[model samples]
Target chain A: MNTFWIILTGALVAASCGFLGCFLILRRMAMLGDAISHSILPGIVIAFLLSGSRDILPMLIGAAVVGLLTVFIVQLLSQNGVKADAAIGVTFTALFSVGVVLVSLYTAQVDLDLDCVLYGEIAYVPWDTWQWGGIDMGPRAAWGIGGVFLLSLLLVGLFFKQFKLCSFDPALAAAIGIPVVFFHYLLMTLVSFTTVAAFESVGAILVVAMLVVPSATAYLLTEKLHVMLFISMGVGVLCSVFGYLLASWMDSSIAGSMTAVSGLLFLLAFLFSPRHGMVIRMLARRRMRLGTN
Target chain B: MNLLLALQDPNTQWVLMGCILLGTSSGILGCFAFLRGRSLVGDALAHAALPGVCMIFLLTGSKSIGLFLIGAGVAGLLASYSITAISRYSRIKEDTSLAIVLSVFFGIGIVLLTFIQHSASGNQSGLDKFLFGQAASLVKSDVVTIMIVASVLIGLTAILFKEFTLLSFDPGFGRGLGYPMGLLDGLLMLMLLMSVVIGLQAVGVVLVAAMLIAPAVTARYWTDKLSRMVVLSGVFGALSGVLGTLISTQQENLPTGPTIVLSATCFFVLSILFSPRRGVLARLFRFFKLRRKVLIEDVQQALYECLEEQAGSSRPGGVYLGIGSAELALKSGKSLSQVKSALAEMVRQKIVAERAKADGSSTWTFTPDGLKNSYLLVLNQRLWDLYHMNQNEYHHVHIDQSQEELAPQLTEEMLEKMLAQLEAYDLTPKLTEGTQAISRLYAREQGGLSL
Candidate 1:
């Protein structure tokens, strides 16, 4: 039952992250996702302190606000002639450091687990059951992650055309009167929401891994965005299940194991994917060379 | 009081020294990364150090700081190499590759970390400090190691400063000059890797990238020259280090790493908002000042054109006639209020005067000084317009000055050429007749202004 719950939590997080990750990868803002994930640390800590409890609502709101702020700051800096990557690095680290300092400063009052934020407590997910009217419900993570995943699905589905157009050619999107900046923040908000909701189970950095690796692998497999989205979600699910089994075998961090499995899948796709595999391309070049000889 | 006592402790001294050295070296090396647009590569290298540290611990079965540093260096380099290879050989973009290598290596490291924690020997390892960094853990040996690494990094950066500068700005040019650009690039990567490895013990892997990034970025706001920027970045880095150490020691349970990062961020924020050259406030000030100047110049051009239109019909009075602010606004394509404000500025400068009309309105007329200035302004505009009209032919000619001092800026040949071009278009100002040479016009203006 614990294994099932853990895998379910991982799958939900992965699916949500993977879906959004496709757009992020296409737009070349993959590191921006990583930055948002790390920077939201302060938001979580602040929410924990302000609300004086481990309530999900305040945490989500806090993280969403900070996440958007991160994007805004980066955009502001880049517009002011700072290099984009440097702006991202400066903003996120500063915010993440503040989060860490805050977590350390009020350790006694906060009672927030730092380890759980970094490495995740997915192994203990099943134990953290959500109860309703004297009835035992499943893991709270599944509920939170499920809600975020559904929201992500609905929003992305409704704005798929806008998001797709913005990702491909922002200039054209703006030319056609689509609100490029609005859709950009909307995507960032969803990413922040998914990251915060999923962080409890997969941790912060692994959330980045879930967002980037599966979508990147799918990107190699197909040229179509819809096909890419589906493949990315499928890859994310595979990572979650296989990662759970691998963690059990190694008795290691489940989130870490999941990330490792995703990396492995990416490597496999890089080497063997039918259309864009490195090994296949090399073989094709070799065959052409042989024929010429 | 506690902070004073804490400063007196030798342990605090070592941590302080270690952090300063770490900051100075990384700040210097960070300039290159920031310049090359590879700022986040430091982040990737920092995260990639984790799996290396874990593997080294597993192999050595010991907890030597020296061994961990070596392991981290090797791992960071390998990760950099893989990132380069992945992007070079595949369709995957550099950023995506960076994200992949960073998260994946970190994931592998986390797995190893948990594995080590669960092991019997894990209790003694204390490797998790590398995650957020605990500067309190630095011993004498660690400080010495950091000192050696810092010296090496600084020395190499100084020695190859020019080559690295070339690499950062234009690698193809360096390659054309037979400078072995590829080898220089790899050496730079190695230096960056060394800095990250040494910094891991102090700032940790998570926030060390900021140490490399924020100081350099802050320095960029201060100067445009490479050498000055490198020095300024190092100073900022070391300053933040000292400040972070001091502040963190003032309070209990304050980890030095995040504090250092926060201080660096403070410097970055200050630089971004207030630096003289590139600061937001400075730029905004310059922008508004330029806008005002442009607005005033536009009003002058509009008034001059209105005078020209009137002079072309029935020569207006020997003296200039007053024009209404409303007519000026329409001619200038500006709002009435904006034109009024600009005219008010002109009045303050004694270039124009507002005369009350019988109908409860006002009109502006140029002063004698203003008439001469307007004539020069109109002549400069016509000269520029003529140059632009023949821009294709005169594209190679560079004209830096276009205000009242325009005639002296160009050489005799180019000025005559431009004036000749202006005469052909019949666009030359009537005040500065095309029949007279520009040199004579300059002499007449220099002799004494008589309009």
Candidate 2:
């Protein structure tokens, strides 16, 4: 039962991140996603300081605000003639440094353990079960991630066409009177909410793994957007279950094992994907060379 | 006082020197990273180095800086390879590959670290500091390791400065020049990996990328020349390290890495705001200067038009008019105060003269030099309008800056060609028609974007 709860929580976080990660990778904003995860550190820490507890709601709100701010700062810097990558590098690193300073400064006053924030403890997650009128409701982390996953599903389902249009051709979407920037921020907000929801089970940095790895692997295996999304979500759930078992066997970090497994999954796709495998492509090129000779 | 006390301690002195050395090398190499559009690649490399450090510790059972650096370097190299391969061979973009490589490698490192922690040998190992460094714990041996690695990195950068410059700005050109481009690139990445590894004990994997980027970006706002930028970046990086060390030493529990990054960010903000050339204040100043020039030009064009309006029916302007502030204000579409300021400026430059009329009202008239200036200003405006008249829509013209001072000083042959061209458009000898052309151009400009 403990293992079930832990794996279920991991799967929920992974699926939501994987869902958002597809868009991020397709739009070539994967690193910006990484940047937001880092920059939200200050926001999360500030929320902890204000509430003086480990409550998840305020932290999610704080993370959403900070995530949007991260995008805003990066946009402002680029508009000021700073290069995109440099702007990303400067803003995220500085914000991350602020978070680090906050963690160090208010070490005793705040309940956020810096070590836990760096490398999360997924094994202990099941112990923090939610209670409603003395009924067992499972771990709060699982519920939080489950709620985020549902929200993402509803939002994506309602606005699938708009998201596809905006992602593929923002200028065209704007010409057609769709609020492209609004959609952009909406996607960013979803990513922020997802990051905060998964913050406890996956840690701050490893959340990027959940956001990028499965989607990138799916990107290799499939060409259709919806198909890629489904595949990545499946990969996310698969990795989470296997990752928990692997961690249990090794008695190691569950989040870390999950992330490592995601990478291995990507590697496998890189080599064996039916449509875009490296080995197959190399062989095709060699055959063409031989024919020419 | 705390700073002074820390400065006296030999241990602090060693750490300070170590940081300075680390800062200088990272800053210099960071200039290349900034130019290459690969600034965040360093962040990926820094995160990727963590597992290598843990792997080395597990294998050697010792925390030797040398072994850790080799391990980290290998890990970073592997990450770069995967990034290049993914972006080049597959449909994955460079940025996606960077993110994937970064998180995956960092995840592996974390897993290895967790395993190490739960193992028997983990009790004595202080390897957790690599995640977020504790710089105050640096001993003499660690500082020595940093200095050695930093010197090698700096020395290689200095020796291959031009090759690096070419590599950063234009890798294609470097390849064309047959400079062993691949080898040079590998060498630069190795240096970057070494710097991250060296600083792992002080700045940590999380914030090492900051040292590589902030100083270089701050320096970029100060200069355009690569050499000067490199020097300024090194100075800025060294200052951040020294100041961060001092401040953290004074404080109770602050880590040096984040504090150093904060100091570097302060420098970046300062440069962006106050640097002479590329700074925000400088840009604002230039914008205002351009605005003043535009206003003054408008007044000049208005004076020339006023003179033309008074000429006999169908006759050219051999006439002069002492226009009042109200008429000038109406003609230039400026406020009365704005018109007065422009007039005062023209008077100071002897471009216009103020006279008291018999009705006790002051009227402004263009002097001889002012007349010549106004005539040329009107001609240039007309020429621009006519130049784009052939196109379906008007386009904004950017005047050659080198010839800006020569606008009124066109030679005999050049003036003849210009006036002849204007004559062909039926715009010559009729001053009102030229003004009409300019108004039409301005109206088109104001309507909407051309495309």
Candidate 3:
């Protein structure tokens, strides 16, 4: 029963991250999410330093601020004539390195460690339960991730039209007076929030994999945005469950197991996704040759 | 200060040498990728190598550089293969396909790393440094290995340079010329994969992509010729490598990859601003010169018109000419001094004359030679317009015969009709004795009788 709750908690958190990740993938900001995952560390450390405690809200807010700052800094650098990829590399790596340094400096005083920031403790998530209204709620991670998921869902619902417009043709949206830059910043902030929430449960490195792989896999499978969203969410949830199972069976880290599962899913999509699969394409070529003959 | 001392130390020579070799080889091969618009493949392949490195470490239980590099190379090749396969099979964009492969592979690598960390292995903690690279730890053996690999890469690129250029510039034409484009493309990918894999140890996977792209992009700003661009890019790459290595070696905790990227960025900025011919400063200078010439021509033409008006109607006072009367100068919106300077330039060209004035604010008039010159300029402009029309309407115009040979076939009536169409745009054809004399001279020069 306890094991079931733990896996369920992971699946819900993973699903929430995947839901937002679908839009990010569609927008071609997969690497940006990876960058954000690395950049949020300093924020977490800063929050701990200021509050002298490991509270969720302050850390989440701190990480979110850093994530937003990362995007803005990347945008500023790119606008000042740095290439986009180069800007991303410069901003995130510098922030991550700073975070590493800070953690090292404050190791004895602070509750935070670099390992927890990097790989997270998904297995230990169920142990940290929060009591709300005198009822024993599940893991603190589940609440945090679930709250973020609801918020993201509401944001997506409210701004579906704007997101679609911006994603498909930002210039056209700008011409039509849709506040393209604002929407872009908003999207980045939302992605940052989700990344921070997901980081606590899935680990930072695996969060990047989760945010990118499922959505990318769904991209190969479908052309429609709504279909992609649903499919990516499904893929994310399944990978979490299957990964937890694999980890349990193999007696390995659940985060690693989940990432490996996601990678396997991505590989399958790359090699055998119906229209875009490699083997099907080879067969199609043989048929074309036969028809020509 | 400490960093500066470290940079000058003799012990850092091997690191510098390795960076130079890596830069030269990657830059040379990167031109092919840049030309093919596959520059981002470096990033994709770098990320893709993570899983291979981790898997090799897990399997071998050893950190032999040879085995690790082999694993990384295989992964890079696999990534290249998968990207090609994805692009061939679906309508997904090349970048998107690359993103997919990059994330998945990196994810797998992370998972494997986490497992390794969790297991009872002590060596796993330091492995993440490979993600960003640790240049300070580079040993003599590693430097030698990089040089050997770089030499092989450079040799391969040199041997296949011609075929690679042909395929890169125009694959369809290369195919028509009976060249094996498939083989060339495969060979190019192989070289790129090797460069990236070998670079992973020194620069690490994080900044290897920047090495490939930054030099190529910087080289593009310096030259239009492919050979020059390749050579310049190689130089830029080597400079970036040396500078980055030096900076990182000096700074205690500074990563080499980011420093290398920063150095390459400086090269890119310098080339954009200062390269000859195509640089920003050159283009801006040319624009200013052209503007000045256009202003002078406008002033001269305006003065010529004022003189023609005075000759026709005995209007010696000529309707009070001012800066507004100078059409080109007025249109350009130059200051009064600039307009005067342009008028003075026309006088120097002998296209206008200054009438003696009491206050030194002279009125301008055209000389007889100037009137004739203006008329010829107007006629040439008309002819240019007609030539453009002919170019658009008739794909080709053959003028093999002289005026006399064409005179009978092209009657005065036909010429009148053509001139009427031309005059609709406000051009008037004058019956000048000089024009007739020139036509006769042209006919004789063509060895045909005058009309």
Candidate 4:
């Protein structure tokens, strides 16, 4: 029963992150996604201070605001002649430093643990159950991450065509009167919400693994967008189950094990995927050489 | 007084010395990374060092800075290789590869770290400090290790400054020059990896990248030259280290790594907002100054065109007569207030004189020097346009508009040819007889002054 709740929480996180990761990698904004995850730490801490609890609402709003802010500032710096990578490095580190300072300063009053924030203990998820009207509702993380997963699925499904167009060619989208900037901020908002929701389950930094690795593997396997989305989410679920089992077996960090599993999956796809695998491509070239000879 | 007492403590001194050495090394090597547009490589390398540190501890059942450095160096090198390999062999973009390697390696590190914590000696190993460094824990031996590594880094950077510069700016050209560009690149990466590995003990894995990125970027805002940038970056980094260490020592719960990173960020913000050449304030100032110059030039050109039109209609008397501000505004297609302000500025410069009409409104006319200035301005405009039309090769060439004399820009033969071309097209600026009289008066005044 405990393993079920933990795996459920992990799957919800992987599903949401992997869904968004598809768009992020397609648009070449994967690092920006990583930056947003790290940079939102201050926002989460401030919200914790303001609410005096680990309530999800205030945390989500604060992190969403900061996440959009990260995107805005990165764009502003790059436009003003700062190199793109440096802009990302500067903005996120500065914000993350502030978060660390805040966390250390009020360590006593706040229940936020820096270690837990870095590498979350998903094992504890089954213990911290939420209650409603005197009845228990399993773990709070399952609900939170589940809500985010559904929100991403519904929104992404509704605007699938528009998002596809926007991701592939923003100029053509703009020419056809689609608000490119609007869709851009909308995507950023979803990414922020997903990141904050996944914070409890996968921690902050390792959530990037869930966000990028599965989608990147899916990207290698297919050229179709919908197929890529399905593959990524499927791989994300697989990582969750394997990661939970691996963590239990090794007695290690659950989020870390999940990400390590994703890494393994990506390695497999890199070498053996039928269409784009390096081994297959090499074989094809060698066969052509032999035939010509 | 409190600061004096704090600095007197040997513990504080060790921490300070260690931090300064760490900052200087990271800042110096960071310039090359920042210049090559590989700033995030530092972040990736920092995160990748964690599993290495954990692995060494697991294998040896003990911890040492030297062994950790070796472990971290190997891991960072492998991460870099994997990044390049993924991007090269697969269709994954470089950025996605960076994110992949960074997060996955960090995840693996976390796994190993947790496993270590569960071990018998895990609590005593003090490995969690590497996650968010505790610089207050530095001892004399740690400082010695940092000093030795820092000196080597500084010495190597100094010796290979020219080769590294070539590698950063143009590796292909360096290859053509018979330098082994590949070996040089690997050496620079090794230096970067060493700096990152050494810094992990003080600044931690999370914020060490900031030590590399912030000071170097701040230095970039202040200079265009690479040599000066490197020196300035090192100074900024060391200053931030001192500030971070001092402030952290004074407070109870303050951590040294974050405080240092924040100070470095403060320097970055200051440079972005206040640096002379590339700062936001300087760019804004130049933008407005250029706008004002363009405004004044447009008004002057419009007044000359109005005078030319009047001369073509009836007679040459309009040059001496003043035109109303409203009429001038209409001719210039500018607002009445804008035209009046421009005219007032011209009056202050003695380029134009204004007289109060019977209705108490101002009428403006150019003085002798003003007439000559406007004539040449109009003539240069027509001459350049005609030259551009005839000379397609020089279409994109920029002319120095600030020079008072055109002779420096165009040869005598070229000028005569351009004037002839302008005359053939009837595009030369026409001056009325009254304007010619004003020009002659200005010539005579100039001749008298020279005599």
Query: Per-residue lDDT for B157-212 in model 3, tens only?
Result: 78878888998899999999999999889888888888887778767765577778
Higher-DockQ candidate among 3 and 4? 4
- Residue by residue across A1-293, what tens digits does model 4's lDDT show? 99899898998899889999999999999999999999899999999899998878999999999999999999999999989999999999899889989999999987878888898889899998899999998999899888888988999899998899999999999999988899899999899999998997788898889889999999999999999999999999999999989988999999999999999999999999998899999999999999999
Provide the lDDT at B227 for model 1.
Answer: 98
| Model 4 chain B weakest 10-residue run by lDDT | B442-451
TM-score of each: 0.91, 0.91, 0.73, 0.94
Cα-based lDDT at residue B259, candidate 4:
88
- Give me the candidate number with maximum TM-score: 4
* Candidate 1 ranges with C-alpha deviation above 4 Å: B122-125, B302-321, B324-341, B354-363, B382-451
Q: Each model's C-alpha lDDT?
A: 0.87, 0.85, 0.73, 0.87
Off by over 4 Å in 3: A1-156, A159-208, A220-223, A244-257, A267-293, B1-11, B176-178, B291-451
* Top candidate, metric DockQ: 4
lDDT of 1 by residue, A1-26 (tens): 77788899999889899999999999
Q: Is 2 or 4 the stronger prediction by TM-score?
A: 4
The per-prediction i-RMS, to one decimal, reads 0.8, 0.8, 3.9, 0.8
lDDT of 4 by residue, B1-451 (tens): 9999999999888888878878888898999999988899999999999999999988886667888999999999999999999999999999999999999999999999998887657354668888877788777888888889998999999999999999999999999999999999889889999999988888889888988999999999999999999999999988898898888878777767788999999999999999999999999999999888878888988887876665456443332345778888998888988888899899888777776667887666666677778878878777766654666855555567566455458867777877887788876677632544334322232221000
Tell me the tens digit of each residue's lDDT in model 2 across B1-451: 7678789999999999999998999999889988988899899999999989988888888887788888998899999889999888888889999999999999999889989988867453668878877778788998999999899888888999999999988889989988999899888888887887888888888888989899999999999999999999999988998888887888787888888999999999999999999899999999999899889889878866765564423333222336788898999999889888988999889887776667887777666566556766777777656544643322333345355443355556655766787888765534332454222211122221011
Model 2 score (lDDT):
0.85
- C-alpha displacement of A10 in model 3, angstroms? 6.7
By summed lDDT, the worst window of 10 consecutive residues in model 3 chain B runs over B441-450
